[model samples]
Target chain A: MLKVRLIPVMTFNGVSLVKTKQFTNARTVGNPIQVARVYNSRNVDELVFVDIKATEQGRKINLPLVKKVIDECFMPVTIGGGIRTFEDINDLLGIGADKVLIKSKALQNPEFIVKAVEYFGSQCISIAVDVIVKDREYLIHQKNDEKVLMKTFIEKMHQCNVGEFVVNSVVCDGMMNGFDKILYQNVSQITTKPIVAVGGAGVPSHFTELVQTNYNGALAASSIYHFTQYTPQEVKKNIE
Target chain B: MIVVIDYGMGNLASVQKVIKSLKKEVKITCDKKEIQKASLIVLPGVGSFEQGMKNLNDLGLVDLLYQEVIQNKKPFLGICLGMQLIMEKGSEPNECNGLGWIKGRVVPIVNSRLPVPHLGWNNTYKHKEENQGDTLLNNFYFIHSFHVLPEEAVECTYVDYEFRMVASIEKENIFATQFHPEKSQNAGLLLLKNYIESYA
Candidate 1:
């Protein structure tokens, strides 16, 4: 098995890097270069720079912003948010983004996921799934931001041959309360690939506890970047 | 001095920047004289197989690159489309023939489910390699839609997404990477450093 990675989430607002809660209440945290430098120095596994507003704005992956992050980061980086075209993915990879994340688009056009894998090779493909409880079922977020059944999408995505999945519970994210293990366990039971849990990660032990059972890694925004009680290394140490 | 073959297709500045990071002397030149005299030459391209070759021909460097990299055996490296150019032919175009230095062809990354233009840091599954990390294409950064599917992979880096294309190739004095080692963080930087210390 490949090494389980610990990816710290760096969500962007326009060109500036900011910290937000459940996709709201944006707060200026620091520069992307400075934050990336911290992640680099701390010996984190890799970093993910997500543009929370890109989808809402109907754009592709922010190339210049990705370049800015790559210019400073020493570790591997995975980026998402508004990546909608092959050209965008190509340009992003060309410029320097190590990996590109797709959630809504994969749901919209599963063939894009397949073509993405074929063109770049499957190793570069990353599938992201945002899950939430709707009428007592785990539903997925469609491209139009609508809700659909999760199991069907997960099954299809696995068929798409995505290397990894970043599964975050929409209701649980940014709350720093905890992770929705139900969502993780559900996906883990279905797919053999690595799964990284995102959303509501508040403490160092949270990551450790999650990886113990099934999930490969736990991603946190508030605990690592905000509370400052533990470094990514320390958090990883606690988890391992 | 190492010459970064100026084909005007790829991220030249980044490649140049990476070479500089290794504290090595580099020149971005299409001049065959300058390139031929250099100790090493780099061929980098970002566009499709056809346009890339067209650009090289239009710039009058296709033959120049062939003479230097293929014939001279003066340590040559290709990145992405540049790497594909070493193969005999690609799906690029009819007139868009590669240097034919290596025996192979560029095939689309084939799969029914995955998307086109694979983009990301896919872990390399080395295809039985003599070198784990070298001048280029180790466990490095990769971003592309098409790759050089060599007849026999000389060296490969393994990754999880799929059996990745040959990460790096070493034949005689020629070396190339389907993935961009320059953009591959420390692993990539180390490759450049190796090029400076050992090959060049």
Candidate 2:
């Protein structure tokens, strides 16, 4: 009786919360803590907070901002962006983060994912696979403007035994159209790990459509709670 | 005071925050003296069974917890890894011995065609018909790969994920759950409140 999860993905720019389109053209949305409080009231399944600018700024996600957000909500929070070492993971978890999302670091040094799983256990460590579709193929998108075959990256990380995979589409980000079925179909062929599909969800049916296909969860940013009139609870009702 | 035992495994802060919000006196400590002074003890953890036992042993908390929970009969609650550690043995990363507080063995969930780490919310049903109205029977968040199989009949609640899996257990002064009540929101908060009111 495992229920599919509809999680809200919050993109932060170190200080303020922002929403991105295609992983660029960041637009400041609202205060991080206030957004968290609203989600808390709605009782969303889980919350994913990524400091989009942390990697470019060469620092970890703003801890004070994260701590304040954690205080405002009493649910699972996944912290990501600019995580380079084990200390960063420990610091985030110490401040009440349920799981640490590793993106750039996991690609740079895959060994870190193995070590992280060995030390913190698979339940606490999740990897975010940001991808872009090119020529009808998925490519692993990196901040340094390098792209690798998505299949190769996913197969390699699957061997590390991480808890879950967050398959996010950089091209479809903030588009509010719908999810990329081909992207999910491609990743599903590689591994059976729990997947949280991210990017390009415009409506509640968009979530239902993805969940009915393959993903165990759907993560949204600009749809439902952000840009539309539907609340998370209302979306959950639609899914149910 | 309710003492949340900290063995450096999982999110102790969220557990502390939830208990604090309930307006109950709570403390997160591994100190022996503080534990002895506590009116109730809560062990909340998230990790593998082997590592959890290792950390508890290295911190010299194994014996202390045994004395307080088993011998002294102090009201005790174990969450996730905490609940699994009460079993006599577990086969997660490898075969390892547990605290043996309960006569059971922890093993990978059976008949679950779903993912390994069965992560998400699921509805739980009370084992006893009379306990159908139990607040803990509501949907709760769970994130784990293993479940316990008690050797003896104990009051329990179960969730069906291809098979009936133990979700929560209750014995005289011991109460434990495989799901995280802290992260479960309203249903979770109500469960904690019920536990505190019944024991503390």
Candidate 3:
């Protein structure tokens, strides 16, 4: 049987590793290289690094920093944020990134996703969908403060033939409470493709809740890893 | 020296980095001379079967690989698409010919409730207990939509993903795995170390 993946998401502010609450109030946590080494030693299933401000800054993620981080990782690493073109993807993959996550560019131009999938294969391309809950309904949250219906956005990207969807809950990000189960359930209903639930994982029970929903993977940022005593292996044991 | 054949497929750095960490002299190149000098050849790739074959052909590596791996019997290791390419044929995107080193056909993983591209970590079991030292029965990272079905019985490791699928194959000097041992953390590193030491 395929084991459910436990992925640790490391969000960067271009220079340093940081944590965000509801996608705002960026707080510096630790050095990314050191953090990646820790994850490598812990033997986490996979690692994700995202440059949260790269797209808005109109530049690509810090390549040198990512290269150093990847050096410390033996596990598969996914690189994202400010990924706008074929060159960006090529550079990251060349530096040993196993997969590249596309968010803003995927929405701004769905054709880019199609072309990327066609050229790079779906296994290497993952689409990140950030969602915010409004009136008990999931809405797609854009960097520019504009919110679109989550269903419409998901349906549009579904046609692009990307490998998997990294569905993140902005409202539950860095909350240390629990994951948005309904949000994941809704997205799973929309598409049968693999869904990796991100944001709002705080405890072992939270992951157990996620597993009950039959999702493929769980991506946590501030779960027991940063804010508590439980190790990633411990959390994975609970899920099993 | 281990030459990681880089046919412009996908990331070869991870494979190179792992070999370097294992303290083995490794090079990533498409040069015929480098491959000929290599004590072992590692072919690592990620993409469609059609594109993979095209790149190998375009780079003019198909003939060199055949001479080095098949004719000369150089120790060879293939990962992911590298493993798939050893089959007689594949049907990813469309029907295509593979290297035909192994009697098999690569086809989409179907008839399962699980999602396609059987992604993430899964435990592998040895097809026969006697062939234990070569293949480890541990969890390894896997990410692919198509798997190779050997036409004849081969000494292989299998993983259960609602069905038994070939995880790795050990045929004489040729060793190939559908899982990314480089991306599988400690278990992966150990597997690579074992492979190199066995060949060494």
Candidate 4:
């Protein structure tokens, strides 16, 4: 049987690994390649690298950085952050990225998801839905004037034949309390797509609890090395 | 030299890197002449079956590869979509014909209630008769929605997941895996090493 995967997500700013608070106040942690090598040795299920500023800065994904990471690391790596067009995804996949995450652009043009799925099997594309609560309701109102309901966006993407989804909690992001269980459960209820619960993972039991709810994977950034002594191995053992 | 077929389908870099790490000479190219002179061939892919077949056909490699792998009996290995392309036909992206090297049809994995793609690492123990004290064909990284149902089930060496899906197939002079050995850490590297170092 395929076990539930425990993924360690490293946010990058150019070549340096950085930590952010609700997607702001970036602080350099270390070299991404170096950090990836460490995770590789740990035998984690997979890895995710998000170029936090790529979309906002209006640039493409860091290809060299992705190449360097996949060179040393021997697991499936998903690259995200500045994926805006089909060419960006093509270039990333050409360099050996196992999966590419699309966020802002998908929201602007939902049709891109359909096209991407048509070209590169649905398994290769993951949609990252950044969500925050507004007026006591969870909504996908990012920095732009455009907005869509979280529930509606998920249904639309699923209909578009999206392979998986990364339901990011903008309100709980970097807060380190725990995951937005409500959000994850709600999304999981709507679609059977692989839900990688990101943002606000503070401890091992947090992941343990998420797995009990049938969440496909748990993605941790700060909790792995910053706030806890638990390694991915330890977390897996805990759940077992 | 071992030639890794570059049909403009999947990432051939990691495949080349893994083979090189095993202290073996390897080359990545689409030229039919280079493929003709190679001692061994590795076909790696991770995209649509239709496109994968079209790329080989466009490069004029289908007939040449048939002569080399089937007629010449050169050791050939396919990975992921490459493995799927070995089947008689595939039902992905469209109903497309394959290289027909193996008697099988590639279809989506529907028996397992788990996610469609069946991503992540899983253990693949060899069948009882082929177990033969070799552990190289154990755990590997798999990422695909469709799997091959070969006419000769004995060709399959490993199966896992909820439905005992086909994981790795091996016949005389030909070996292919549904999982990516290059990305499968030590177990995968050892499998590649065994393929290159242990001649048949």
Backbone collisions counted per model: 33, 0, 0, 0
**1 versus 3: better DockQ goes to:** 3
Off by over 4 Å in 3: B128-137
* TM-score of each predicted structure versus truth: 0.68, 0.95, 0.96, 0.93
Model 3, A83-199: lDDT tens digits are: 999999999999999889999888788899999988887888888889988887788887676768889888887888787788888888889788888888889889877788888
Q: Compared with the true structure, what per-residue lDDT tens digits does model 2 show for residues B19-105?
A: 898898999999999999999999999888888999899999999999999999999999999999999999978999999999999
Full candidate order by DockQ, most accurate first: 3, 2, 4, 1
Ranking 1 against 2 by DockQ, winner: 2
Highest lDDT against the true fold, candidate: 3
lDDT of 3 at B141: 92
For model 1, how does the per-residue alpha-carbon lDDT over A124-147 read when each residue is reduced to its tens digit? 568878777878999885446566
State which candidate has the highest DockQ: 3
Q: What is the lDDT of residue A110 in candidate 3?
A: 89
Off by over 4 Å in 1: A58-63, A85-87, A104-125, A141-145, A158-164, A189-195, A214-222, A236-240, B1-16, B23-39, B43-66, B78-172, B175-184, B197-200
Q: Chain B TM-score per candidate, please.
A: 0.86, 0.93, 0.93, 0.92
Model 2 quality (TM-score): 0.95
Give stretches of model 2 more than 4 Å off.
B128-137
Tens digits of per-residue lDDT for model 1, B1-200: 98887775645767776776677889988886898789988887666777777777888887777777667767888888788888888885354567788888887777454444454455564444434454224455565666776776465444444444566677877877777776666766777788666866
Docking quality tier of model 3: high
In every candidate, what fraction of the native interface contacts is reproduced?
A: 0.06, 0.91, 0.98, 0.70
